[model samples]
Target chain A: MLSPKRTKYRKAHKGRIHGLSTSGTTLNFGQFGLNALQPERITARQIEAARRAITRHMKRQGRLWIRIFPDVPVSVKAAETRMGSGKGSPEFWVARVHPGRIIFEIDGVSDTIAHEAFALAAAKLPINVKVVARQGEGA
Target chain B: MANAIKLAATARDRAGKGVARETRRQGRIPCVIYGAGQAPVMISVDAAAVARDVHASNFVTKTYDIDVGGVSHHVLPRDVQFHPVSDRAIHIDFLRIDAASLINVSVPFEFKNAETSPGLKRGGALNIVHHEIEVRCRPDQIPAHITIDLAGLEINASVHLSGVSFPEGVVPHVSEKDFTIATIATPSALRGKEDGEGDGAASPAEAAKA
Candidate 1:
């Protein structure tokens, strides 16, 4: 007796092994919580660190990075725009990571040293760092 | 001797979108001044004066003396909203700067020695990934423009973020070292594929078929 020829192999196995995704559109990573430092609580040291981190990262990476430090007691209007009354700004400080970019979203922490540490850490990233911010309604 | 334009403006009494629309109908641009730890003050700027500045690529970081309500504010461009279809600046935002406050702004990048660079002479092309970089410094310490020197770069040579130098008090926002800003690369062969013209000389089989 002759065996039945296998005609449906490609169709049955193709495009299914990848599991749960549809083609054509990009993948969605979803959102995460973000924090902003209180202006009055931020220290000079944090601001200095932020500056240093930005400088150092720029040196190690071949891309330009921007340190976005919000002015303390930022105007209500400015805050509305910067933080966006809707969901707040997704990024406060941004840096270059090869083939992509990295941003830091820190709320209530816009200080000299905090910014410095953030930058210093960003410079050491071995892989892509995409810092996104998602702020919920306040308590 | 210099192209100095005197413009007039009005202080916005009611601050909101409705007021802004009325201002625009009168051929004016709504703007605000903030910084120096003071509340943001809403003002109107001459629509024409703002349109002129918007034409420049480095308008945002560039300093300007804006007179509003009989008071002049030392400010820099902050943000601008543009018309979606026309892409013309419809609204503008200005940030007041105290000479002493450290400010972060992006400076225009200017390439120098490009014509004589080895990369270009050797058939390699220069690709500028970025046209500008943001910097932080005092108002007086702000740089007018940033310079990128492409001297003897060879094919595949890249200039990174760390390679750039900043004027005193002006520093890049990134903390990484050796981040790339621009690169010299061999031009893509696919560029001419659509037109079927290039140095990729037709294959023997293709030549024979032709």
Candidate 2:
């Protein structure tokens, strides 16, 4: 659902996602968040689902900040067609979930509530994640 | 020391998420400058200029003369908010300062005379502990980067904050403790190799005895 209005070029280079990730290591916005342990392409639908889970758990009381945004365009080919011609049509937009990147952050709620809400949100994602709290919040 | 740069800006009065978003849409960076016994002044500057300045080495230390609608304001960048996906600078906060302002700023380190160090010549690695030292100084008196002379350092030798020269009128904020800046250490890989050789020599004699 979230795609860039314009791009320099249609397709991007296959970037190397391997090696240790360096960004998104620190908690920035919210009190609690989910840190990506493995690289993934998180879809907009998955993010929406995660958002719904958090909103449902919090009962619209606290703020939920989605750290990642679905901006990278992922193209797709027809399933039953031949594997020739040009690159496939733009299928969906995805947020590249590199390791150490915060996926979601929530604040203004109790620790127990934040934990359960993040747990529910984490289930919708595909990559390995660890729930992290704001430094000095608990320990 | 890095030269102080000038940035063009427009003064804004309103403050909110919608306002910030609108500023971004107009290709500008929304910012607020407060402190120094004055009320907060909201403004916006060219996003590209802020991005370029943010990438400079002295981004956190250098003084910026932001020209907002013909009025000039000397300030230091306090924070920069980037777009989540694009990693572009969207918003920023600049703290207003003056010649009389003795604000605390972190000045990063610049290792000097590394080639002259005997320990470094023998494959010793410099382990930096404090990347920067917070100092209370005027905006014009802020040092771009503090240099640590490693000429006299040997392996296992530590350089404390007192060893580096502080700029005139720039006093370190930490008067309580003499913190270490960096240390010359033996490389772990070399140490491991030397330890393996010592163990191998001892094992041969022990094996012969057995």
Candidate 3:
């Protein structure tokens, strides 16, 4: 799973995602992209799972880019623990994704392969996604 | 010069978010034609017609003859705003142009002879640095697209702006440096093989395991 090596604070506050993403909305590096259709907090494990699915479907033939990173540390309280003991230790990392963000990009693959790869990857994600090709390129 | 595509549109009296939304609800795309010292004209074109054109190749470079309420306007597509989620055309901006007008337009590159490139044959990736190059030319002289030949390129070889040939009277907008347009880059799998043989440093995965 992807996580930060170090951080300024051990635990961070959970933030809210609002509105559509203003950046990372366009396909900058690849010919095909998987676009987010709703806002959600995606865990590092989920990201890794999606990446594995995409790479496995592509047979590692084309290049892939994960546009979003799991930077937010999510902490949890232990089971059956009655009261608050300050804050629970950081358990995992998550990425707050906004609507219209391009979560994954792929290149050097045929349109059919790219679409299939994205479809396999989308099953691992929590939000709805659509496969998009770069404008003026293959549809 | 390529023949201008003809599109019919209706003039609209109002312009705003509400009006634009209303226009979209009626299956029309809100558009504006401005430039050449003339007042801007607010119009609405058929949603399907404009969407087809926008999705086509070299949309901005294509010239259009827009007939607004029986008045003809020669224009070039300047910008398109798409709905974030639906990816629908929400708004469009068109620039009025004429024969004498010299405009700077971004022309896409059409790479040719990729199969003949020695670099591509060796499992190298054609990493495009610039998909399009901005050029200054008369509206009528704007080439549909610039061609970049990749016939004899080898791994790590680069094609720069200086090496490209443009049509008569069309010149690259940037005159400062010979910027790279594309390169035959080594694939990551090939890079890994070279690195393992050349260096003793532990890979990221190996380091993580440790």
Candidate 4:
């Protein structure tokens, strides 16, 4: 799983994703990309699962880039805990992904392989996604 | 010089988000033609036609003869905005140009002789720094696409802008530094093996296990 090695704060507030992403919306390093269609908090485990799906489908032939990182620490309270206590310890990391963000990018793969790989990866994600191609590169 | 693609367009009376949406509902894309010191003309072109051209190679550098109602305007595709979810062409900007117009355009790079490159044969990845290079040239002299020959490039070798030969009268927009366009990068699997040989350092997986 992908997580930050160091941080200034141990835990972060649960932020709301309001609008479409302003950046990382285009395919920068690859011919095909997986674009998010809804806002969600993607955990590190989900990202790893999606990455494994993509790489396994591609047979590790092409290169893959994870555009988003799990930097926001998500804290959780223990079961049956009282409400008067303080915030719980950091449990896991997540990335706040807004709509229209390119979550994954792949290169050096055929059109059929890229689409199939993205389809396999999308099943592991919580949000709706679409396969996108670089302009003038794929159908 | 490449031949101009002819497209039929109609002059539009309004310009706004609502009007653009309405045009899209009618299976037409809202486009504006401006530049060359002339007033901007709002027009609507067939959505399917614009989508086809947008997906074609060298869309920005390609010249277009858009026939607006009756008047034909010589223009170049300045920009294209796509719908976020559907990946459809929502809006397009066309810059009017003439024979003497000096325009700056980003030309796509078409790599050649990749099989002949020693680096590529060794399973090295061609890391492209710039998919397109901005160049200033006349509308008539704009190259379709810049050819990058990777015939004898070796592992770790880089192709710089200064080493590329552009067509006559076509000059790179950036001249201050010799910017690297692409490089033959060593594969991560090979890099790990080389690092282990140089220093007896354990790989990430081995370190994690420890």
Leading candidate by DockQ: 3
What proportion of true contacts does candidate 3 retain? 0.20
Each model's C-alpha lDDT?
Answer: 0.52, 0.73, 0.85, 0.84
Ranking by TM-score: 3, 4, 2, 1
Task: Candidate 1: list runs displaced more than 4 Å.
Answer: A1-139, B1-7, B190-210
Candidate 1 Cα deviation (angstroms), residue A18: 35
Once superposed on the true structure, which residue ranges of model 3 sit more than 4 Å away at CA? A4-9, A83-85, A137-139, B194-210
Per-residue lDDT of candidate 4, residues B1-210 (tens digit): 767889999999987899889899999999999998999999999988767778665888889999987899999999998776677888899999998878999998888999999988887777888889999999999998889999999989999988899999999997559989999876545665644432221222234554
Task: Report the error of model 1 at residue A5, Å.
Answer: 29
Across residues B1-210, which tens digit of lDDT does each residue of candidate 1 receive? 112234566788898788888988888888787877788888887777667567565566567777776787777778887542233566777787777788788776777897778876765556666666778888777776778989988878988877777778888865556567778765434333463432232222233555
Worst 10 residues of 2 chain A by lDDT: A130-139
What DockQ values do the models have? 0.01, 0.02, 0.37, 0.34
Give the alpha carbon lDDT tens digit for every residue of B1-210 in model 3.
588889999999998889988999999999999999999999999998877778655888989999998899999999988777888888999999998979998888999999999998887778888888889999999988899999999989999988999999999998659999988877666665654432222223334765
Arrange candidates by lDDT, highest first: which order? 3, 4, 2, 1
Q: Is candidate 2 or candidate 3 better by TM-score?
A: 3
Q: Using lDDT as the measure, which candidate wins?
A: 3
Q: Candidate 3 lDDT, tens digit per residue, A1-139?
A: 6677778988999889999988898788888999999999999889878887887676545577788888899989888887867788789999999999999988877899999989998999999999999766312
Model 3's DockQ score: 0.37
State the lDDT of candidate 2 residue by residue for A46-138, as single tens digits: 887777677677754445667777777778888987988878887777877777788887764678999998889889888878787743200
